[model samples]
Target: MKKLCLGLPKGSLQEATIDMMKKAGYTVIVNSRSYYPTIDDDEISVRLIRPQDMSRYIEKGIIDAGLTGADWVKEAESDVRVVVSLIYAKQQLTKVKWVLAVPETSAIHTVNDLQGKKIATELVNVTRRYLAERGIVADIEFSHGATEAKAPDLVDAIVELTETGNSLRANKLRIVETIMESSTLLIANHNAWEDEWKRTKIENLAMLFEGAIIAREKVGLKMNVPNGALDQVLKKLPALRKPTISSLSEGAGYAIETVLDETIARKITPELKRAGAEGIIEYPLNKVIL
Candidate 1:
């Protein structure tokens, strides 16, 4: 009965991570004010750690593996094995950006304009390196939080994470430069990854997580098509590879099932109906591993 230490990202990514685990066929229960969460899998021990520190912990082997932002891993300069890159965030399935921003009325309009200026951000190290790479020597200050609110009046500029530019716009800040674009990553400790048993377990988890994310954008569709209209129905359908066709035991037609993009489900349904697809069924999917 070997066990694997796993760290789930806390704060903003907490809910999404939990939901993903559920979709991946695991149940996780978090108690109020507790860092350790209860996961149904006895082989896994769960700890809730902030994404910012997740890489550091994994690098030090404090946890075997974790889910964290790619930005943090680069900022920390941690040495770890990346299991997978998950393209999802708090709201959308897209990479987020950390941008250099200044007040709309500020005199600085570009990264070069920030010479000898001060920039506030939680990602102080990465910001410093970014400025240095561009031969810009701006002072990088560590912001505790509310980094978006510290422009012009508080600091010369701010480097803040943004999924959409709306928040920066609302704060009267304009993006001057994109410092980094990051997505979530599943990373593992080098030592843990070397162990045969742990490596297999971590790899299995990665596959499940990946499958769950893919399942989000797809759905399972099942329908019946008449013998005469099978060609029409097949033409109207799209699939992961090809639709599954099976002869109906008591009919002059076939039962067809396939997986397709959720976004196109509605549009294709009516077309499928017109193509003589009957008893049409559309269902959600938990995992669609390829």
Candidate 2:
């Protein structure tokens, strides 16, 4: 098998990224002081590296693919091709604000308030262009980590990525403005995509990752309904595709199943129940393929 190199980000995001890989069916067992992780897939080479430098690494064709935040790739201004967005353990929640935050009690009330102020952020390039476009000039502080702590320490405000905003709230800071929204991105070297074997390996990994991520946000919903209510149930139930329909051996009933987004669970479940669906069940899924 042709070997394809993958760069896994190390740090807080490492644990979740590795978990995602395992769930996607590649065994990756990490150990402290080990940059290379043993994997079930002997065909691929896995290398753990700092995400801060991954964008350029991938762009320079040093690695075939890597996991890093969209914010970092933009900040690095590298020419890496983003293969996919992996939301990790938290899918729906990860696609959220990269915000400008300040202490709740601070005088900064809006984006306009950042003018002529100091702002600490890890996404200096992204933050700089954003601020520059608005004709606002601020003393931008480069933070390697914990940018949220900047405000309470009298750093004026900060531009940082937030998934739930809980960290910002705990730090006594409030979101002042949304600088940009970001999500975890699968990026690969442009030249790597030119090699059929290397490109195919990375693409397969991305496809598997997407399937796993989609399955997490959704479930296979199944239920039984009397044959007399088939039409009604079909009319009432919300489905992304045509629901799988099969008649029971008795012929007076049918089993129906469909994959649906969990976001509508509250409304869909009740509506389905009212439509004569019995023995309703929802099962979490991984790596759903079409």
- Backbone clashes for every candidate come to 0, 0
Question: Per-residue lDDT for 38-129 in model 1, tens only?
Answer: 99999999999999999999999999999999999999999999999988888887899999999999999888999999999999999999
Each model's Cα RMSD: 1.0, 2.4
Candidate-wise lDDT, in order: 0.93, 0.83
How does residue 245 of candidate 1 score in lDDT? 98
The most accurate candidate by TM-score is 1
Sliding window of 10 residues with minimal summed lDDT for model 2: 87-96
What TM-score would you give candidate 1 relative to the actual structure?
0.98
Best by lDDT: 1
Model 1 misplacement above 4 A: none
User: Residue 209 CA error for candidate 1 (Å)?
Assistant: 0.1
